[model samples]
Target: TELQSAQRKAAWADVARRIAHEIKNPLTPIQLSAERLKRKYLKQIDTDPETFATCTDTIVRQVEDIRRMVNEFSDFARMPNPVLAREDLRGLVSAALVLQRTAFPTIIFTAELPEDPVIVQCDGGQIGRALTNLLKNAVEAIEARKGNDLPPGRITTHIVRTEQHTTAHITDNGKGLPVENRDRLTEPYMTTRVKGTGLGLAIVKKIMEDHGGALVLEDAAGEGARASLVFAQGNGRAGA
Candidate 1:
């Protein structure tokens, strides 16, 4: 157990260091060049000022977006080891749903929490982050659906505890997983969206793995996506 943990930590640290180095290298130059062009061309341009401004603004905005994504890479690479404790799984799911509701008001959000607590040994913070990422992905998937007659987006969270494992399922009424390479969705840098960095699902998968669990993504019934985070029922104490 100790050796596996150490290996995992080392792998992540190396990934973080490499990503930070690679991405941060060109960002500064890109930012500075955009600023320089804006300053030098703003007054000297004989053409429309608005066009120049828009171009410069676009470059600046994209740069910032990439910078934000780099930060996410750093966060994932340097993710802390989860501090395991007995925590209420229902409460955790509730907190995630509440935040997502506020963040995406148009989307209908629902939860199916048991009357009794579904307790689990987990790192609440890490699990919470994983939940948030999954919820965010669901929202994005709904937004990406193309058509005028599509139904209103809906997301549901449910928890199921069995004798050997506890599972939290997040289902969304959105465009489901792609038919090709669906299993690779959790791999790093794999994304369906034009603007997505593709690290969110990868991070969630790593978190689940670190907790001695797994992340499963599937196409919901006829449409939409379903993501399940499965945790082993260590000692069978969860939900007791």
Candidate 2:
């Protein structure tokens, strides 16, 4: 089963790499052409200037969106190997939480980090990226639940250390876990959000795997979903 899973992921990665390469080249030219058309024809269109402007604007906007998706595909296909080193997990978590808090002021973000430093072998940048991605997902989930007679949006970050591992849990009061296929959410191109690129969790999972860790997705105790980043204690180079 594990071998099958690995084969599927490899196939997906190859597909992503090819798709990204093919789609990225035309995007810039298309966007530039749309802009040029708008600049040249927007003033001369006397019959329905609004429609012409809107169409050109939509083309430019959609091209940018496609470019973003292609970039995500490239990132997923070419994820860098982790440069693991001893670092303070609490500091990493705090920095990422602060970023999310500043970005989403309305959401109440709480951190329950331990007083003493919890050090782990990881690439700090990759870990921070993972935390930020999860926090952004939480924010999106909370936003989706708005106007549903829900309570104030809240996100909680807590860290726990065991004898063999260190786990950081991000819990949010938003839409709960999906009713089905929860286990496959980390696979490429699988997402519940309509606008999502679906590569965020896949990239995060790859990062965790590179660090000899795992990404765990589950439902929170009461509402919304919780994502945990579990790092194996004293891990060295990946696959070592």
Candidate 3:
């Protein structure tokens, strides 16, 4: 029994990790192109139209999210060594929005960033996954709060540079995380959602630590939640 359990898990984990790494290489461009078309043409097609274009766009966006999360699962099973590169945080954030914009057409996506590019040493694929997860969570929160009494929500992301660290923060306007859940949010297999592997946040935390960064969860000021990733400042290529 024990041997079966150990071997099965090990095999599954390897498969997952390999899948994540293999698919990861092409996911970005596919997602970005789909996003560009969705943003500029979602309206052009029809009217959230359930028409061909609109339907295709929505499907692409959702598939991208699934792919994004799947990447996390893959990372959990088998992670690659840090392919550290000089990356611009702003570009990563924008690309994340581009991939996800369709999911929250109603929820306002806001950005606060510096005029100059802020660069960090990171694995673009993994770090991008982290940001996407945060944004996805924000959108999910906004969706859950949608109802008779609740108004539409907003998600705000920002990158700030301190003397020694670069911090990327994501905040959302929705029912704030309960006090009890805060401590367990990053723990594997812990989530309020009926369907969640609960590995997204855990993957984010692991990626951060691997790159000399830290992930923080705090109560948002008004009615939602804020998450931040702080990374050690490093010299980087000026552009993304």
TM-score for each prediction?
0.78, 0.77, 0.71
Segments in model 3 whose C-alpha atoms lie over 4 Å from true places: 1-12, 15-72, 235-240
Report the lDDT of model 3 for residue 192. 87
What is candidate 2's CA lDDT for residue 147? 69
| Superposition error at 134 for model 2 (Å) | 1.4
Q: How many clashing residue pairs are found in candidate 1?
A: 0
Model 1, residue 171: distance off in Å is 0.4
Question: Could you give candidate 1's per-residue lDDT for residues 1-240 as a string of tens digits?
Answer: 999999988897987879787987898899889889999989988879889989988988898888878876886787778888888889889899989999899999999888998878888998998999999999999998999988999999999888888999999999888888787988889988887888999999999998889999988887899999999886227453
Comparing 2 and 3 by lDDT, which wins?
2
lDDT of 2 at 117: 81
Question: Lowest summed-lDDT stretch of 10 residues in model 3?
Answer: 45-54
lDDT of 3 by residue, 140-199 (tens): 877877458676688999988878789989999877786777788998767887657788
- For model 3 the local lDDT of residue 208 reads 87
lDDT for model 1 comes to 0.88
Model 1: lDDT of residue 166:
91
Clashing pairs in 2: none
In model 3, the Cα lDDT at residue 233 comes to 68
Candidate 1 residue spans exceeding 4 A from truth: 1-49, 56-60, 234-240
- Candidate 2, after superposition: displacement of residue 115 in Å? 2.7
Q: Judging by TM-score, tell me the better candidate of 1 and 2.
A: 1
